[model samples]
Target: MSEILARLAAVEEENRQLRQEVEALRRDHADHRETVGREIASDRRRITALETPAPALREKTAEDHVNRLFSEMRRLNIRQTTAKDAARLLGVSKPLIDKLKPYLATDPRFLILRDPHHKQRHLIRLAGT
Candidate 1:
């Protein structure tokens, strides 16, 4: 029947238009997903940068270890075999000796202070035996 054919053709045209709209929506969704992914990557890089602390903290920690051990050795009145004594023991800068002397107070066998009046001193002292 002619009426049946017209109805079928109208349905097919509507189906085709719906398919095109669905394809457009899919492309839009894909583009949005790409944009969101890029934003996530950029935010991740920013978070990583902010989470990381930039400092010579490790070197400073080494310095503190050297200071603590040097003071402990001095407080215990241990004899030094070499300038390398504290340097070798703490695995830190042997040159720290020169830098630390102004703060170094001693009684021949005693190390009196490892104070960095200009900086916060990280001191760990061992009780004398």
Candidate 2:
């Protein structure tokens, strides 16, 4: 009877230890899951940032095009040009010339004028010339 009771006590102690081990494993699993979730969220944010296009790059490219257009006009000694002629000189579409009108209008180096002979035509010229 004494031997049987000792054996039973040993079994109970082993069961308690197993339960503690299982609880520790659960806690470790929870921590691992939390860490993985945070990493996934961070990756998503990085992806979103990468996917968004940069507007500054487009604006810089447009500014370069405008500068090139001005250089070409100066090289050709063109004091003034119609939108169609400017588009042809710049090797760009007429709609692009229309888009550039705002930039030309705002710049102190350039002037925009309405054609007296043709109401539909606008003349772009170097300022003060």
Candidate 3:
């Protein structure tokens, strides 16, 4: 009976130690979660701060740049201009001028034409001019 009691006491002590370890683990988990949350919130704040100054720092909006391009197109004496010419004249990337196709389609003052002799070449021209 004394031996059984001693074994029971040892088991109880082991259980107590296990409970303490479990509690410590819980605390460590909570601390880790709190740290991660703080880091995520800090990242969100940093992203917002980086984004806030962009508009005021921009040289011009897309609309303003496109309007400037139209004005320049109007001032040209030539009846028609190629994409390369327009890109050179506007001092903008060819892809940027290419993006204007949908806008040009809707505008009354301009037309897009394909060259039959030189396949795949496109021209921009003043309508009825």
Candidate 4:
């Protein structure tokens, strides 16, 4: 009977130790989760701050800059100029030529014509509306 009591006590102690370990693990997990949540919220706030436009930004947007360039080109009556040429005239990156091309392609000001007797190259001119 004494041996049986000793075994029962040992088993109870083991069970208690296991329960404490489990509780500790649960607490650690909860703390880790809270930390991760805080980090994610901080990242989200940082991203939001970056999303807002600066107060000292330019009045001329990319589209506006492109439009101004086109107006300058028409005023100068300079046709057959490549995208690089326009980019130079506008003092912007060359890649912006691709971005602005779509707007000017549909405009009536654009005239796609081949030079006389020369099918190897093409010239873009401004046709009168």
Candidate 5:
């Protein structure tokens, strides 16, 4: 009966060691999961930054929209139109049409004139059109 008691003590010690090992493994897995989550968050922020355009690039895109509006006007043979009308026809925002005012004023191929009937309105027209 002494040998049986010794064998039981050995088995209990082995079980305790195995429990400690399992707890250690669980802790390691939790740490790894936290590290991976942080990495994923950092990568998402990097991707968002890469996707956003700088202010200068955004202005360039708006200018491209203005150029497209000009092409559309020419194609449609529109001699004159209001800024609001142009915005509607081009499927762009009104602010973009407002931004085009300076370019149109300086292009020489186009003209900007005040609307006689509306004090706060203006007209854009192709030269000689």
Candidate 6:
């Protein structure tokens, strides 16, 4: 009878140890799940940031185009050119040059003249020249 009681006590002790191990395993599993979930959320945030588009570029203003035209004319040593030629040199539409005509006429840095060779054409020149 005493031997049977001893065996029963040993079995009970092993069962208690197994329960402790199972509880430890459950805690470790919860921690692992929490870590994985956090990593997934971080990865999703990174993906969202990467997918967002950049802001649109700023459009060039008329003054900016005019400055570029003037710079090109000076660099090429052009004293005078017709509106059509100026538009071609500046890589802009003729209508844009037409829009700038009034401003160029009033500007102190430029001269507007009638082309002697072409009755229908106007010439643009630097003010000093």
**Model with the higher lDDT, candidate 5 or 6:** 5
Write model 4 residue lDDT over 56-93, tens digit each, in one string.
42335645765676688778877556666777888887
Candidate 6 residue lDDT tens string, 82-106: 8999999988888778777776787
Better of 3 and 6 by lDDT: 6
**Could you estimate the TM-score for every candidate?**
0.46, 0.53, 0.50, 0.52, 0.51, 0.51
Model 3, C-alpha of 69: deviation from truth (Å): 3.0
Task: Estimate, for each residue in 25-126, the C-alpha lDDT of model 1 and write its tens digit.
Answer: 999999999999999999999999999965533555545655676576776676432335655665556566544433443323234334454253432233
Clashes (backbone N, CA, C under 3 Å), per candidate, total 0, 0, 0, 0, 0, 0
lDDT of 2 by residue, 1-129 (tens): 999999999999999999999999999999999999999999999999999964343566567767877888899999988999999997888977887888888877789999888989999998868
Q: What overall lDDT goes with each candidate model?
A: 0.60, 0.87, 0.77, 0.71, 0.85, 0.84
**Predicted structure 3, TM vs. truth:** 0.50
TM-score: model 5 vs. ground truth = 0.51
TM-score result, candidate 4: 0.52
Ranking by lDDT: 2, 5, 6, 3, 4, 1
Query: Which sections of candidate 6 miss by over 4 Å?
Result: 1-60
lDDT of 3 by residue, 1-129 (tens): 999999999999999999999999999999999999999999999999988853331224445655666678777676778877877887887776676666666677778899666798888887878
| Candidate 6 displacement at residue 49 in angstroms | 40
Query: Which portions of model 3 show Cα errors greater than 4 Å?
Result: 30-67, 70-79, 82-88, 93-99, 115-122
Q: What TM-score number comes out for model 6?
A: 0.51
